[model samples]
Target: MTLTHFTFCSAFILGLMGLTFHRTHLLSALLCLEGTMLSLYLASSLWSSSFVLSTTSITPMLILTFSACEAGTGLSLMVATARTYGNDKLHNLNLLQC
Candidate 1:
């Protein structure tokens, strides 16, 4: 397959898998969110690589940085929640009546 076709196929698969996996625990959902972000970054990079210069590089770097921070914060929060509540299921969050 060509570059464009490969990009499209991979983006589609990653997006689909991300959506599908987002309904699980906090870590899985966070990972899925990251996967979706990666898909968007890859598609944008591949599509614009033919015309633009490195103007797009800054955005991807920022996105990567933000995603890393987000994942770290999420993991920390998950650890705290699990330590307090004994589990990390999304539904378990609703058990917090306070």
Candidate 2:
């Protein structure tokens, strides 16, 4: 297809791979989320170029805002987890068990 389609597809594939293979890495999850966001952004930008008052505009903006908020929260959680366990590994978050 077009470059836009290729970008979206690549981003989607990367996100899926990161999610599947790096479940224990918060950084990987963040990267996957970013990839998903980028794909959505690219799709929206492309769609908006062809239609009037496209829903894609608002959708991408909302997604970006949510992604920013999610990143902040995820970073905070990672920091807290790291401090408590001296590492950022997902398996190290066993403090809840105690």
Candidate 3:
């Protein structure tokens, strides 16, 4: 409805598409995930601002903290995968074979 809403929605959709299209690379997927999280953070912050009755909602902070943790974990996984497989390709992360 509003410009902010449209912006956030489009950003989220673009991030989702990027994640899908870039699934072959671990780094790109992680970046897309981060972008999605950023859009979510912006949306949540905007929503929280409307609730003037309360001082402020902790949703934005919580999302930020979770995103940071997710980024750290994803980076570590990518680094480990690259070291183990010589490249960070998602297809190479197979666990079925012994």
Candidate 4:
């Protein structure tokens, strides 16, 4: 009923949708990762506001920074895989079959 709960639910739904609809492993992974980051941000912000007296603002900033790094790394890997395989489908990545 609270904003935090709503945010978490929304993030969870988005993750589920991403998993169910995305055929490409890379895109699905990115969507899941983004959903996770969004949930974390919302939770952190909620807690920070509720416990403003004791909470540090830097926590959310650190989480954002890590999320950015994760996104960058994931995108780079996706691009590399697409370039090498010419497609981003999960089942098509058979580099080890050779």
Q: Tell me, by TM-score, which candidate is best.
A: 3
What alpha-carbon RMSD in Å does predicted model 1 have with respect to the real structure?
3.2
The order of the candidates by TM-score, greatest first, is: 3, 2, 4, 1
What would the per-residue lDDT of candidate 1 be over residues 1-98, giving only the tens digit for each residue?
89877876787687678667666688787777777677766766665666577776577677778878888998998998799879887776775666
For 1-98, candidate 3 gives per-residue lDDT tens digits of 99999999999999999999889999999999999999999999999998874645888999999999999999999999999989999987778867
Worst 10 residues of 2 by lDDT: 51-60
Comparing candidate 1 with candidate 4, which one achieves the higher TM-score?
Answer: 4
User: lDDT ranking from best to worst?
Assistant: 3, 4, 2, 1
Off by over 4 Å in 3: 53-56
Least accurate stretch of 10 residues (summed lDDT) in model 1? 42-51
| TM, every model | 0.69, 0.80, 0.92, 0.73
Candidates in order have lDDT scores of 0.75, 0.78, 0.93, 0.79
What's the CA error at residue 55 for candidate 4, in Å? 4.7
lDDT of 2 by residue, 1-98 (tens): 98868878888888888877898867777778788877777687667767777555677677778878888998999898878778777776565775
**Comparing candidate 1 with candidate 3, which one achieves the higher TM-score?**
3
Better of 1 and 2 by lDDT: 2
| Better-scoring candidate (lDDT), 1 or 3 | 3
Write the residue-wise lDDT of candidate 4 on 3-57 in tens digits. Answer: 7688787887887777677856877868787887878887787677767665577
